[model samples]
Target: MPPSPSTRSQAAAPPRRDRGDACPGALRLHQAADGHLARIRLPAGDLTVRQATALADAADLLGDGHLSLTSRGNAELRGLAEDCGARLATLLRDAGLLPSERHERIRNILASPLAGLDRHTPSDVRRWARELDALLCASESATALSGRFLFVLDDGRGDVAALGGDVSLLAESAGDGAGPAGSALLRVGDDPAALRIAGPDAPRAALTAAEAFLTAAAASGSGAWRVRELPDGHGLTARDVAGALRSAGIEAAYVAEPPAPATRTSPPYADSAAPGIVEGPDGDRALSVLAPLGRLTVAQWRLLTAIADADGSGALRLTPWRGIVLPGLPAATAPDRLAELSAAGLITDPASPWHRLGACTGRPGCAKSRTDVRADATAAVATGTTVPAEAPTGSPPSGVPVSPVGVPVSPAGVPVYWSGCERRCGHPHGTWVDVLATAEGYRVALVDPDTAPTAAPAPARTAAPPAP
Candidate 1:
């Protein structure tokens, strides 16, 4: 069994120092081999339909026609020209996407993408997430947080919780009048146990906790920006975090142990029959959609805009899993609209190829990559390989796909991911098959959950492979 939340402990290590983090943003673009790379922070992954359309337009006008999704639930516009930052910033600002220039990069927040929409979730994690973003943006010192710093808000489920956040607030059931129906448990590093605070105070408490972390990191003289990198002696404690919350006027308590949130393997998708009615706990429903491989062509992007125009009432939630959910649609029009989206290759089914496959900007877009991993993965998929399916409660068995093309890939199963090099960007969580590029060609490895890690020998191929 996975370690319970209460039993988890922080690592003991001295703090390490760093000058500062240089993660780029819309305002501060990073020059890549292809062009400029600009990451747009979508706190709680919320974007208006207009905002989504603007991003698509930006990609077409200032960067590549394609958009890349970050593991942090942010969007990346690559292949941008040298002079596109100011233009891009202005465009996003007008669209209500760029709220704070200084805080844009540091505005890293992940929440339950399907919260309020998913049947099993208790509350809309988006509300808490937005409140937290507002708090962070309003803070004068929050600019100190590195662009890479992350915050996760899970609604009593272990989805985003598994992504390994720097500061996390997992929601739990609460008592009436004690607080909202849910409480927030704060976690630092990978520790299981966390400090609990009122649901209403969760945003404020999280801000205070982050401030405390920054102060500790500075005091230790370890220049560490991330909680986990803090040296042994400089590690944070639940008691210390509780004290910080109290100082900030937010009530908090250290729980000896908290229940480990359950993990949900299924990705969010629209209910074809119900449409806007998102399934929640006890047969409830919500509006949800997937961004294929988290990349959208201009045409596909337009389709999303059309859906938003027809179904979404001016709001769309960008999920941390690189998808979108539109809440409050008319039940009558939703099914037909969802059908249109499904016809366009958006995965509304729990099991779909787009949900299972993820790849980085390899080859032409990235100078460091040895091959176009995305193209390669697409080629592999076309070969009719039977993508892996989600394993049962027991340990997963090992094997490669039997057929390569037209097979549904399971997000929770050991699916295949291609990398330009050893740095496998956008790699999926849980079990997976790794195909790494080398000077001698691709090296295939099957990651096993039950035994020591080992690599599978590459299959012999003809001098020339089939066209992708």
Candidate 2:
């Protein structure tokens, strides 16, 4: 199970933020040891061929030769030249990637990447994501939101429901003894209660929910940048948010109890040990491609574009799993494309060792890192011993057991993430295997049910000291 909102969003003893969030954006770059880092938020992770190609060009020309996929389904360019911001901005602008400079960082939205293409989804909510993005950008008050604030649009499959969204719009099943058909359940700040509104009003309702949070945060006067950051006594309720929705001309009524959050699990398309081709009901298909360690070279990205151009809709959706979903492909052509992608070093088969591993950019790029975590992760993956035993049920201290350091754990394809230090940046949501770099070596643990690290006394057999 995922952690509660308070546990997930709030650090131990909530710290007040007197300054704005330092999250990087296309316009605002972060100076890293590698170079400048720029994050480009793609609303709903929608990327056209032109925009993707433009990003590839920027990566090759203005930044590093590769693009980094973020866990938010956004893209980041590292090793960026110090003076290339203007050119990069112009290129992104020309490709329609940057719509609002002021609202760029605040546009952190993650939706079901395979919403429309998947058969199990209730309805396509990609349009809702776009509409909500536009609404958020249009609202001048929304500019006050911290870049860390997030919004999630789920297509009733729960794939993205547990991703810690500050505001969430989940689709309700029609004719299932639920209120009205096609109504969206809008909840703010992980509150179980929701504001039920027509499907068409979901975007406006989400915007209104943001406004309500902003209002409450303002009242707290704690400079709360997110709903969770507001003072403990602050109240967030469906009725209050519904009232705000009504003021925004979005008809919403309070629901005493909304449906329980969608189960947090890997999408069916990726439930196996490796990502594979997803065949739709109508013979349409999508090739699920994973980037090794969430890093893609320009040539590899171009290869993806070529595959999409040849076999898909020329559209790719970046997933929060640090992967790319190429939708609208003919079922017949998917197999060949997957083969080609696999041959090109992309993880197309779930059984591949790369299927279970991910890592944060550790050394060189991050000044705080004690070791090159990515290199260590790659070495771990190469050993095929990355999977860990099931996560323990209770909260425990965070560290690996040194008593049985060389014990071999069978492969279960459990998701394992390597972090440079304690922060565990970009770790996957839900229960996952965690490997943290430490002075003693690497500490491996399965994140506890409470989302705290529960480390055994021994590291897995694959644990290796990070390269200097």
Candidate 3:
């Protein structure tokens, strides 16, 4: 079984702060192993067609022309030149991408990628997301939060909640008008559901809750940034959070264990059989596009923008899984547009090569990686050795079948990930087979499905003879 929320919350050891977190941003780039890395924050993972194209252009102009999607629903440009940081910042700013330099890193918010469309969801979570973002940017103290600090506004589903955010506001039924017209359960970590606030006030309540955590961190003087890192006795409590909300003139009621909600995964984009039937106001139909291995080229980015302009609504939604959802497109034009994307090697089918596969910025992008893992994995796939379903089952004990080079493919479509080293930065969220690169070649194992394992040990690639 997956670890209880409390157990998961306690897993992170108190972070030892040597200095402030220097996580790269569009304005502040990081000198990565491959080159300079710039991370552009996408609040609520909303991207305009033009903005998406701009990111692709930035990648091609300043970096290696490859874009990487982060777990936080942001984008990363690797292999950037040290000198291009300023120019890149200017380009992003002109595109209305970087609104605040001070609040850039603190804009970590993940909401239901399909909140507005899902019948079960409340009104668009985007509104609350935008409001919370504006509030966070305006607060001077929010700068103190670490770049990794996260906030999730789930549409009552446990999807984003499963990500283990620092602050989470889950929408819930208003309980027959007991409190207000629309209210949600406010929770922290795996703790008992602590409060209930008006649905409209959820954003403010979330911010207040964050402030309470910051206040506790300040009192602890541990220099801790995340809520989980607070010492046992110094942790923030529901009562204290309620007090803080009251002080801010927000009504909040304490509740016990709150009900866990369901979360939505990336809907399959390959199903474009009836496109124009579900049309949007602009006479465009929804087009779901996937980025193979979650990486896209500048040319491909431009092509997507053109497709969206010609065939879809002007807006784009970037899923946490690194896929794009173009809503409001004309149903008649969707099939052809999807074919264009597929011809360009984008994953348009659920059974395509990109489905369960993910890779980090290996080779030239990350200095810590021992091998160009992505290249090697691609080669393995091209040779027809790595079958999509061959990924192993529950954490295969050490010395299990390694790669497509020798292992027989399984019938079930299990997930697999290729990691440069043990860090395994971009491993898939749920059940997956782990293939880690070693001095020898690649170590393979079936990871335990119930518990989300961080990284599994891979045998040295040198252990086995090279495949002929």
Show how many residue pairs clash in every candidate, following the order shown.
33, 6, 22
Question: How do the residues 112-186 of candidate 2 rate in per-residue lDDT, one tens digit apiece?
Answer: 887877666643579999999999889899999978788998877677777778898888766445767778888
Which whole-number lDDT from 0 to 100 does residue 56 have in model 3?
Answer: 77
Residue 3 lDDT (model 1): 28
Candidate 3: tens digits of C-alpha lDDT, residues 302-357:
78788767666677777666777776666677788888878887777765555656
Worst 10 residues of 3 by lDDT: 459-468
Candidate 1: TM-score? 0.83
TM-scores, all candidates, are: 0.83, 0.88, 0.83
At residue 454, candidate 2 shows an lDDT of 68
- Candidate 3: misplaced stretches above 4 Å? 5-12, 118-123, 173-181, 192-194, 263-284, 383-402, 406-415, 445-468
Q: Which candidate wins on lDDT? A: 2
lDDT of 1 by residue, 119-195 (tens): 56665577888898998889999999977678888887677776657888888765322234667778877555688
